[model samples]
Target: MYRSLLLGLAGNSAAEALALRYGMRLGASRFVAGTTLGEALAAVKALNGKGIAVTLDHLGEGIRHLDEADGYMGAYLSLLQAMNREAVNGNVSLKPTQMGLALDPVSALDRIRAIVREAELHSLFVRLDMENSPYTTATIELVRQLHREGFSRVGTVIQAYLYRSAVDVKRLTVERINLRLVKGAYKESSSIAFAKRDDVDSNFKRLIKIRLDSGVYTGIATHDETIIDWTRSYAHRRSIPRSAYEFQMLYGIRTPLQESLAREGYTVRCYVPYGERWYPYFVRRLAERPANAAFVLRNMGRRE
Candidate 1:
């Protein structure tokens, strides 16, 4: 049922209907910055003013077809150019399939190389976001190739909930890859992933300690207060300097926690996504928190 909601939002017309029906403002708050490049940049400026860094993500996944994938790659190249001209205090994140991975491996990797070269020219970073487990190996392969090409500015994500991520973390150290650790948001098989929340949290801290000790640039991406507290205690116990790593969170999800981390002098980056294609993104947020869905429903009547 939740997957259906996400798929529905990915459809442009369905997303429009849902947005209007829900009385949502739909101006790139959590889902995206905006459809226009100017709007996206303006949104970035606003966040930078608050001392919160941003990451530009062209909202998309699952290519329409090979031709469409090509078009998407062209658009990303243009976005990279704009990012260079804008020179904003943020980097770009991309999903491989969106760059043509689904069409063909060679096609996707080449396009990714183009984007990475663009980021390199501008001295920017590119974050390869991890999707479902099916794409994990392919994504890692692409990252490995890219890193071999000397793109330290490139990084990929891992889900701690995956029973195998502990080994993956060590593998990442082989390339000295920067990683964003998240509780696997996608539902997967218990054979491959931990369904219980406690187990996921435990693995998260364990991986955090190892990564910090390994001296890799790690991103602890979660809003769980307990994990945040544990991270603090662990860092303090090891007397690890604050520059060792940073905490990352989704925008519009944990305002208070983000601020608290910043006030304590920790580097906190808010994942700010912006684009007209925000429906799939918003639906995922709602599914993550049914209470948020209920809140939106309560305001439905006001929009009517």
Candidate 2:
């Protein structure tokens, strides 16, 4: 119930405005990296020092203008430059709409191709983040397009909640592409997505096993202990090398587990999102876990 409410409000302009005006003051910093690139880089460096790899995301989505998308492209270019210069141990993940998919798919493709080219130059990887259902097909096409063009460092995500994901995974596996398997966050409809948590979890585990067995580099993106243990046990039983797959978690969602995984000789990457347009992203994070809602609300009331 809370997840649906929060997701609805993610698209509410008035709610976004109010939240953006007060989110930092209301303790959003705990989840968000920071508003500036430098701050985010600092966080990246700190995490790297702890033996954790990173995938940086400069957050903004639902863009509608060409110039706005161009600006985000510039931001990513600058971010890539910084990552190379500062020796930051991380790559990047980006949203298609932030590159102008909503305005024009051709223009969006051109922009993303440029970014992928830049990543290739820097020997960095780019993960095209999966958004809500509307862009799912387009995102997959973008990944395939990049791959066909010889940009091997590019990849995309798959959401387990979607009914079509099993087929999608099977199709993608044929290409031997890198994939991040997530349980999904957006509030999708019952017609297209599994309405029950157990169903989603089951699909997620199944997808992970398929991807792992196929010899593709799979990112097991989850914070669930049961899933984590299952992944570890399955990989161990099958004699899969630790380098064959990695575990991923959001930046602030599971720090201890991330560190523990790293210490245990597993490659763990933290999805670190940073930028001023953090209201929507932060809200979704809260909705993904109800306990986050209570913690944030209690802190907000205490501050009051």
Which candidate has the top score in lDDT? 2
TM-score of each: 0.91, 0.98
Return the lDDT, model 2, position 184: 93
Candidate 2 residue pairs that clash: none
- Poorly placed runs, candidate 1 (over 4 Å): 1-30
lDDT of 1 at 243: 89
Measured on C-alpha atoms, candidate 1 has an lDDT of: 0.80
- Model 1: what TM-score? 0.91
232-299, model 1: which lDDT tens digit per residue? 99999898888889998887778778877888899888887765556666766776766667656665
